[model samples]
Target: MEKLCPRFEKAMGLISTRWVGLILFDLLKGTKRFSEMEADLPISGRLLSDRLKMLEKEGIVKRNIYSEFPVRIEYSLSDKGNELEPVIKAIQFWADEHIPPEETDDTDEQRV
Candidate 1:
């Protein structure tokens, strides 16, 4: 096997975390409010918040706060995050081809 560069290892480490890929994939659809994302994904509010913060720190996600009656916050992919479109699609394609669908009746699987 070839040696892995530190930069590549760092990036892979960031993106490979649980829920990160799914989060990015959802954001690709368009900007989403915090509640909306929470509804769409089965992730806990705390975990989601932490992941969003991490992504923001990495410059992969942008969080926008709107001064409204209730204070609306939305999340969208940054340019760097958008660049992962091909990578996300490739993973989706590979999973579709190689992974068999689960026969579980749990509705959680439908979320992300």
Candidate 2:
């Protein structure tokens, strides 16, 4: 048997994490603040923060901070992260074809 490519394995490891893929998928819409994502995703605040930090470190997500009375922060995909749109869309297409409606949370469908 042949071993998997390290790059591919690492990518899968990162994206396959719980809520990571969903986070990316959500970002496909556009830039969003932490509060926005927290409201949109079912993931906990701590986990979302952790994943955002990880993605930023990996250069897949970009974080912007605003200087103001109260600082504002927003998250957007980096060039590399935007490159994942196709893959995420493909997965969504596949899931739509194969997964039964009952298997997925109906609320998510409404949200999208």
Candidate 3:
């Protein structure tokens, strides 16, 4: 783990950032509006906007703004971004089995 050089470390760092994981997680579902992301994620507007732009620049997300009405915009995963779905699912499975029920707030509820 520590053996990873700074370059890889920085690349991986973006994915592991506080809100980026959840941000990407939700975006993986489908195209989402800025407001939709803001509501679902516990991130500040500026930070979320910044991160989305970063992801777009990284070629992980595609942002499209519509020309109709008040103007609509949405974010969706690119081909490369879709590749991370399996990794996210694996992480979820690992957490479910390894993380203690008491450690998470939803443990009291029935799980799928």
Candidate 4:
């Protein structure tokens, strides 16, 4: 077996976490407020917050705070995050090729 490179391992460790990819992918569509992200992802608010912090630390996402009555905050992809577009697209392509479509009750279906 081949040994994994530490840098590669560390990079994977960050992105491989549950909900991280989905969060990144959602941000790819455009900037979104905290509430908007929560509504789109099925993850808990706490988890989403944690993941956003983590991604922010990694320079993959940007958080903007607006001074308003309630203090609005928006999240968007940083340049680094935008660089992951091809990577995400490749994963999406692979899934599309390998995974079978699920049988669901709703007409609107979503895939990661």
Q: In terms of lDDT, which candidate is strongest? A: 2
Tell me the spans in candidate 1 whose CA falls farther than 4 Å from its real position.
103-112
lDDT of all the models against the reference? 0.89, 0.91, 0.83, 0.89
Off by over 4 Å in 3: 5-8, 105-112
For model 3, residues 1-112, the per-residue Cα lDDT tens digits are 4587987898688788766778778987899999998887777899999999889999989999899999999999999898988887888799888989777664332232
lDDT of 4 by residue, 1-112 (tens): 9999999999888889888998999999999999999988878899999999999999999999999989999999999999999999999898778777764322342366
- Over 4 Å off, model 4: 102-110
Query: Which RMSD does model 1 reach against the true structure?
Result: 2.0
Highest TM-score: give the candidate number: 2
lDDT of candidate 2 vs native?
A: 0.91
Clashing pairs in 4: none
Question: What residue pairs are clashing in model 3?
Answer: none
How much is the lDDT of residue 53 in candidate 3? 89
Write the number of the candidate with greater TM-score, choosing between 2 and 3: 2
